[model samples]
Structure formats: C-alpha cells, structure tokens
Target: MRNGKATIHDIAEKLKVTASTVSRALNDNPRISDATKKRVLKAAKDLNYQPNNIAAALRSGRSKLIGVVVPTANRNFFSSVIRGIEEFANSLNYKVVISQSYDDFEKEKQTIEALLNVQVDGIIASLGKTTKNVDHFKKIISKGIPLVLFDRVTNDLDVSQVVIDDYYGAFQATEHLITEGCRRILHFTSAQNINIYKDRKRGYEDALLKHGIGVDPELILFSDMQLEDGRRIMQETLDRKIEFDAVFSSSDYSVMGAMQVLKENGLNIPQDVKLVGFGNEPFTSFTEPTLTTVDQKSIPMGQITAETFFEILNQKDQGSIIPKKTILKPELIIRNSSINKEN
Candidate 1:
C-alpha cells in the first residue's frame, strides 16, 4: 500500500474489480461505465486512495517541473518575475523550484547543475553578474533540454531570451534631466561586464551628445551599484570638486544612497541637484521627494519568460537553432526628484 498510503489496488480490491478498471475510473476514461466509475470513486474515498505521481511521470515521460534561477531572490524585481512565472505555470499544472546564485559565478554553475540533475522539464534564468562563461548553459542545450533566459542575458548562447530596452530607458532618464536644466549630470553605473549596464551607459552618452553636452569621463562613476558604493562615490566626487548639477544612476539602490549623501551635505534635490534612477523600486515612491526612475515590466517579463520556456518545450523540432528574442519596452516614471520648480 506504498508505506500505509492507500493505492489503486486497495480501491480495486475493495470494489472487487481489476486494478486497470480502478485506474481508468479514477482517470475518468469514457470507456468505463458511469455506475462502475461511481462505485470506484466511493471505494477510493473510503480507503483514502492516493495516486503515485512518480509512477505517472515515469509512464508519461514528463516530470511536470520547472526550475527558475536568479542572481538575488530578495529584490522586488526578481520576486515579481517569480510571481508571474508561478501564476502561469500553476495554471498549467506545473510546479516551479527557485534558486538564487547571489551573483556568484561558481554558485550559478552549481545551481544550473542541480536543476538539470532534477530532470526539470525546463529552466528559466537570468545571468549572474560575475558570469562570463556559457559552458554550464551549453550543457543543458546538449542534453536537449529547454533553457530560457530573461533580463540579464549573454550573446554567446542562441536561446530564447527576454530583456527590457535599457538604452531607451537610460536615454529617457538622461534627456529628462537635461530638460530640467541639468547639463553636467553624473552617471552611476556598474563595473561588471553586463549588457544592461553597457546599454544604459551608451544611452546616457548618446543623449548627452544629442543635446550638445559632451560625455565627461570623470563624471562617470563605476562600482557594484550598491548603496554604500553610491555614498562613497558621491563623497569622493564632492571632495574632488567635480562640478555636477544632476545625478543619473543605473540602479535605484545607488541613487537612493546618493540622495542620502546629498541631503547630509546640505544639497537640495531638484533645487541644487536633480536625480533619476533605473528600476522603479518600491522605496522610490515613499522618499522625501519621490524618485524618478524606469519601470522594467517585471511581471510581464516573467509571464513572457514562462510562455517562451513552454514554447521551446513544445517545439516540433527540438534541435532548431532559431531561438526567440523578445525585447520589452521600459517606461520612464517621472516624479518630484528630477523636476526643476524654477524651470
């Protein structure tokens, strides 16, 4: 009875019927008569019959499991994405398992290996900040398993991927500051070799060039984009007397850090210094002066990421090379931080 749990055989024995008939009745096969099906169900209830999902999976050749990997799970953006994936996947009777790499390259590789070992139907992931090699991801492709990437993607793999238009978001932010009468804007970016940061930097530069304000190398600050990094960089910039009237950061955390430092130094936001940040985190709205930032469409990205994974799994030819690439639009959320009341 499978370690005290009632099985199909117990139900069949109770009803004096064959195990096959009980299985068919439980599955609601049309071939079984309604009267017999009703009898089988009654016996199953009385015996507390439980079906073995492992056996069913083996017979059907499907685990009905999906794995999701992210750099950090605590962030609002990644959590929203996970919600979207779970909502859609649950609707299809699939379960999800999530893992975090903490932006560590080795941890990422280990996470992928563990997911693959579990024989999950597919995997959806965002690249880790320190990930520069694609060999671990290639192992999944070699095994003919579907692997879909979202947000932080690498160009080395020909796999289905989803990302926001970072360039456009950055351009919009930079241009908004310019319209607010900010010419010498300081840009806070990450030093890691990630595509999103690179695209944002390019957008920032292009917007400055378009407005006849040349890019200043000294004004571009690079770090991990953490809160402490922002605080330290702003203080250093102030100490060095680098002239800047506005701040455009690629991350909300760093920009928020910059805001605290600015306030502590007796600088007034939108009065003496304008500000804009990427990724409209929840805290942005509750600040003293609301922050202007970009929304990355986290929920939609998660939903589309799940849809893309299923698409790959259901493909007629699993060996196809034409992978899908989806680019979502980013919205600029303007607020009190970047608006110049004087202008």
Candidate 2:
C-alpha cells in the first residue's frame, strides 16, 4: 500500500470503516473519537499519505499568501525592509512569496504576472530603477488587490505609499557642511527616477543657493549607485582638476569611494573637505574618521509599511479612506567626517 498510490478509500477498506469516517478522522474532527483518529493516522502513516498544497489553496477562499517584489534582495537597504515586512506579515498569519527583479523592468513584470497566477492576496513592492510602466501595478489595483509601495514608488500610481523626506535630509546634510565653513561643495548623485536621489540633489542645491553660493554644474557629478561608479567619478574629478572644499554624496558607498581617493591624496576630512553621505549604513561609523550621513529611520519605515498594508486588508470601507502617502522625516547624523576640530 505504501508503494502504490494510497487513497482515503484504501484506508477505509483496510479499517472496515466508511470513507466519511476516514475523512473525519484524518481531518481530526472533534466529533470523531480519539481511538478512531489514532487508527486513521496510523493507516495514513503506513500508506505514506501526503496532503496537496494546491488542492488546499483551492479549498480555502484565501491563498493566505502575500507577494513581495524588490529591486534586489541582496542590498542592505531592501533587506531591512524585507525583514520588517516578514515580521509583520507572519504575525498576521500570512505567508510571504518573494521575488527579485534585479532592477530589470521586464523581469519585474514577469514576476508580478507569476505572483498573480499564484493568486497572492496582496503585494508589497519597491519599484525597480528601470520600472517606468505603471500599467502592471494599475492592473493589480483594478483586480482589487491591496498594494503597499515602500521606498521606491512611482508618481503616477495612486496607491498606498511609505517614504522618507529625501529633500529635508539632503538639505540638512548640505546645510551642516555650509555651516562648518566648507565652500565649493560637490554633490554626487545617481539617476533621478526615484524621489530619494532627486530630493537629495534638490536639498544640496537649495542649501547652497540659500547660503549665497553659486551652484556649479561641473561640481554636480551623475553616477551609478555602485562602488566602481564612485571610484570612476572620483578619478574624473581629479582629471578635471576640480578644486572643491567639500563633498556630499547621496549614497554611502559612493562616499566611501571618494574618501579612499581623498585619503590617498593626504587631504584631511573636514579640515580640507567636509564630507557627508546619505543612507546611514553600518559601515559609516567604522570608517577612519566615521561618516556623517542621513538616517531615514529605515526600520520604522518598514514597520509602517507592514501596518499600512494590514490596514488596507482589514478596512471594510477602504475605498472611502484617502489613499495615503506617508512621509517620515529623516535625521542627520553628524559624525567626525563632517565636523572640524580646532587645534
């Protein structure tokens, strides 16, 4: 019986009981006697029976599954977000289905389709760098599925969104440098598809303008959010013989790149060129002079995102509630890198 396919009827036949009784025992119905349940279990064990997940999902009204799509799960920023999502989702008795798009728009679309095919109850996502099409997301909305966008969100989509105040954070970082007496500040940034980079750029530029400093286009370097991009941009700065007093980078990794070169050239931080980086990553503190960066309250952002998604799930009058764009203020962490010590 274990070698061949085993069925409820097979167990019933062996036990001289009706199929209904066998089913009840297997289901552990309260009405079934303990002795009968034990017998049915033993029989099932002997037959090596297994329940089908697909069949079970079909029987239940909900798949009890939530899909999570991120640009890359490997990134420290996104991994923290995923941790927050998983923690909240688990407490609500829902399972998570995760997929990575590697910042590819087409791959993101394909992953969403697959999630839909599996009938996920909801979706929580951070848009990829290359994701320009909002139609895929719109379709999810049209299907009446709840979607919570965290971190990277599209402006076109009218949905629940959780984000940090990038502009303010950027403003604060740049302002700190200006107050420290660093003029001719340089700004390093990446693509403007996402609001974070754009806001930081704005903050940096605005701070300079407010301080009566003329904005220099040559000082603004566009770079990819990669270690090599940082190294390459620093090299370009050297090749151009661009004299600058300070540097503000939108990414911590890029700041690290700039610092490596600056240190090699024996230019002291803060004394020669004040430095500030966004995204207060872990390595920021351990660096030689430590790093002055912006802390976006990443953990809280994740928790709020999870809470928002759950609220949408439980609210009976979800349509009546205004679509929310929750923005949290960013905190500027001033460290040794950006502050000068008078001898």
Highest TM-score, which number?
1
- Local distance difference test, candidate 1: 0.91
Best by lDDT: 1
Assess every candidate by TM-score.
Answer: 0.88, 0.87
Clashing pairs in 2: none
**Alpha-carbon RMSD of each model:** 2.8, 3.3
lDDT of 2 by residue, 66-101 (tens): 899998887677788888888888998888898998
Q: Which residue pairs show backbone clashes in model 1? A: none
TM-score of 1: 0.88
Candidates in order have lDDT scores of 0.91, 0.86
The 10-residue segment of model 2 with minimum total lDDT is: 52-61
